[model samples]
Target: MKAVVNERYGPPDILDIREIATPEPKAGEILIKVHATTVGRTDACALRAHPFFVRPYTGLLRPKRTVLGLDFAGTVKAVGTDVMKFAQGDRVFGLTPGGYGAHAEYVCLPADGTVSAMPSGKRFHEVVVCEGAWYADTYLKKFNLESGHRILIYGASGAIGTSALQLSKIYGAEVTAVVSTSHLDLARRLGADRVVDYTDEDFTKISESFDFVLDAVGKTSFFRCRPLLKPEGVFAATDLGPWWQNVILAIWSSLTGTGRVVFPTPRSNRSFIEFLSARIELGEFRAVIDRKYPLRDIADAYRYVETEQKAGIVVIEVVPEDVC
Candidate 1:
């Protein structure tokens, strides 16, 4: 099997595609011939070990796992002993949250982990979307977002941002998406009740207030968005803000019982994958893909995503759709 290997953390240039031995499923696991995957913010962060704090979990001296991809969409090649939920040739899409080896042509995941069957009528490349939606779900879960409640999503054009905007609508929240001028129409098309062009005008100056103000791209801070929140409204961010203020504020908020600032840590689990699968099968949710690259050109894909300008998921087709 060929895989994207990054022995040490650095830039996209550090990545190399090398032939590696295929993995076999362990007890209660499934071996997948990965057909498609993605390069997103999480992959970028893990690749570079950004923020300097994730080192302990990823690796203090070096990357714990060289194959760095979180999302995988493929077909089951084999199942381990006692695995009954999946069979050979079953199309699937899910996250490799624990070991982070989805970049390979073949990878193994626990049968009861984040893995799930592909939504009906969806292609392998189309469903390599769990990473973004999984992170977006953290906010919706934290806020306990409800129908009729209003929510605002900042940086509404990126993978996490796009998914957050769409999921908020599915959860019955009236959503206001804040994006640059170029993504205005994209935001509105994703079901944002209102779209704010941050380049043309200041989103903070808008007259609307929200039950939840989420920084999906980690480019904004809570203090800057505080005024837009209702008295009891919550402010959440996907990243630790500048100087790690979001984490600090989250602890303070939790200790003081203010419930003001929250730092959501994305969890990968089968329950969430199932949740997304249902919505996708119902045709109420979809992943926003910006572009795709062949497995051989994944280094270019990483370069593109690191530019920080991609509007949505950057897909890597490990196995061409025609072949799949």
Candidate 2:
């Protein structure tokens, strides 16, 4: 099998296309012939080893796992002896450990790890690349949004933001999406009740309070948006928290806060995948794709995503090709 291997962490240029041995399923794993996968912000972050903290898990000096990719959509070519839920021909999509090796023609994953049947009426590429969206949807569910509740989604045009907007509406919140001028139409189509062009206006200056304010891009800090929240409203961002930060925030919020700050860490699970699948089948959610690249063009795909201008998910399609 041919895979894109990153020997060290740096720019997208460090990733190289090379012929590698195909992976086999372990006792509790399944071997998939990867047809499609996605390049997300997280993947780019891992590549550049940004924020410095992630380096310990990814690698201090170089990546521990040479192959990089997190989400996958592919057909089961084989299953380990311990696996009984799927057969050789089943189509599935899910997340993998160590940002599983989905950037290749073949990858292996645990049988019970974030794997699920692809949603009906959706393409493999679309379903497989939606793991990030599904994860975001799960987090939004924790808020239990209700009708008439005003909610704001910042970075509403990215994969997680787009999913958050649609899921918030489905959960009955009156959605307000904050996006760049070019992506206003895209956010509106995803069911935002009101769209704010962040490039032209500052949303915090508007005279309105929201029950929930989600910064999907992690670009905004809690202090900057605290004034925009209602007394009981919640402000959420994707910034990973240190243990101390979590504890301190919890204590401080209990002491003197009307509004609270939250850092949501996305988790992958089968139920969340199933929930997202049901929504997709019901036509309540749709995958937003920015572009698709062949496996050899993985580096180029990373470049496109790093620009921060991509409106949604960027995918890599892995197929059997004779090129070295």
Candidate 3:
């Protein structure tokens, strides 16, 4: 097997593809020969161990798990003795949130972990964004979004933003997405009722109000968007603001009962993935991939994602020939 091993927490160059032992399934686990994976903010964050929180569990000075990747779509090559639900040749796609090891030819995960059968019709690049979408879905659900609700989503081009935009539309919310000029059309294509080019206009300066404001990329704060939120509206984010500012905002909102700030705890399970898979099959959701890279160019993929210019997911196509 070949994998991009990460031994330290630093630049994307810290990861390099090398021959490594293929993982074997433990009891209740499945060994998947990954055909496609994604290198995005999740992989980038875990690789660099930013925000200083990933250090405790991953490793203080270095990473405990050398392999780095998150969302994966692959085929099951083998299953552990206790895993009866899946068999060899079954197509699967899900998140390895427990351990970052999806950037490789093969990965082993517990059958019951955020794993599910891959939905048909969609390409690997599209399905590979499911994990991030799952997280985005979870955060929005906390607000119990309903039809006719007016909402604003900032950074509406990344995985979480894209997912949030589509899901919000499905729930009947009138979504106004804020993105750069380059991504204005992308947001509209994803079903945003309205799109704002942040490059040309300052969204915060506008007089329009929304029932909720979600900073999908954690690029803005409550203070900047407070005017946009209805009095009882909520301001939530996928990424925590600098120095725990979002956390402080959440607490402040709780006490004031004015503009509430929400930070939903992400929950990913097999059941969630199963539900999302069904949606993908129905053409209700899709992932916009900006680029594709072979396993050998994984470092470059990471660099590209770090640029924050990607419109959606950055897929890493892992054919067995190139990996093995």
Candidate 4:
């Protein structure tokens, strides 16, 4: 099997294509013939080991996992003896933790882990974004978003941002999205009730306030968007927080008034996957594909995502010959 292997973390260039033996499913895992996968911002972050804070878990000096990819959409080539839910040819999509080998032609994951059957009539790219969207949904649910609520999504053009926008709308919140000029149309198409071009205008300068303000890109600080929140509104950012920071924020928010600053940490689960599948099948959500790269071209895909100009998901077509 051909795989994109990374011996160390630095830049996209560190990734190299190499031939490796195919993996077999473990007792509780299933081996997937990857048809498609995505190179998301998280993948890039893990690649560069940026922020220097995540290194403790990702790796001390180098990445623990040689292959780097988080989300995958593929068909089951083989299943472990204990896995009765998935047969040999079920189409599925989901997230993997340290087992980030989706960039390869095949990946093995626990059948019960974040993995789920691809909803009928749903495409691979559409489900590729489900894991990230599940995270966004989890965080928004934490903030108690409800119908008739007004919410603002910063960085609405990125994968997480776009997913947040669509999920918020489906949850019945009136959404206002902030994006770059090039992504205005993309944001609008994602169902944002209103779009703000952050390049031309500062969202903070606007008079409107929201029940929830989510900074998908982590570019805006909680303080910067405080005024945009309603009296009891909540503000959330996707940037990973230190363990102590998460504890402090949780404690502070419990005793504070008017607003709270929160860092969202999404836990992947089956229910979330089921929800995403239903929405995608109903056409309530859509995945945006900025570009598709071959397995060996994973490096170039990472470069494109790091630019922060990508409209949506950047998929890596593992089986390019099978892609339509």
The model with the greatest lDDT is: 1
lDDT of 3 by residue, 254-309 (tens): 78865488877876667878888988898878888899888888889999999988
Displacement of residue 43 (Cα, Å) in model 4 is: 1.1
Clashing pairs in 4: none
Stretch of 10 with least lDDT, candidate 2: 239-248
The candidate 1 region of ten consecutive residues with least summed lDDT is: 262-271
Q: By TM-score, how accurate is candidate 2?
A: 0.91
Q: What is the TM-score of each candidate against the true structure?
A: 0.98, 0.91, 0.94, 0.93
Judging by lDDT, tell me the better candidate of 2 and 3. Answer: 3
Candidate 4, TM-score vs. the true structure? 0.93
Tens digit per residue, CA lDDT, model 4, 1-324: 999998898888888899999999999899999888999877888888887888997898998888888889889999998998999989998887563888888999888888889989876766788655876887788888889999999998878888899999999999999998999998888899999999999889899999888888767777788899888788888764444454366558766843487765677677788788888889998888889888777889999999987877899888874572
Q: Candidates' lDDT values, in order?
A: 0.90, 0.80, 0.85, 0.84
What are the runs in model 3 whose C-alpha is more than 4 Å off? Answer: 255-259, 320-324
- The superposed Cα distance between candidate 3 and the true structure at residue 49, in angstroms, equals 1.7
Task: Identify the candidate with maximal TM-score.
Answer: 1
> What C-alpha lDDT, on a 0 to 100 scale, does residue 256 get in candidate 4?
81
Ranking the candidates on lDDT from highest down gives: 1, 3, 4, 2
Question: Per-residue lDDT for 94 in model 4?
Answer: 83
Ranking by TM-score: 1, 3, 4, 2
Candidate 2's C-alpha runs over 4 A off are 240-259, 320-324
**Could you report the Cα RMSD, in angstroms, for every candidate shown?**
1.1, 3.2, 2.1, 2.3
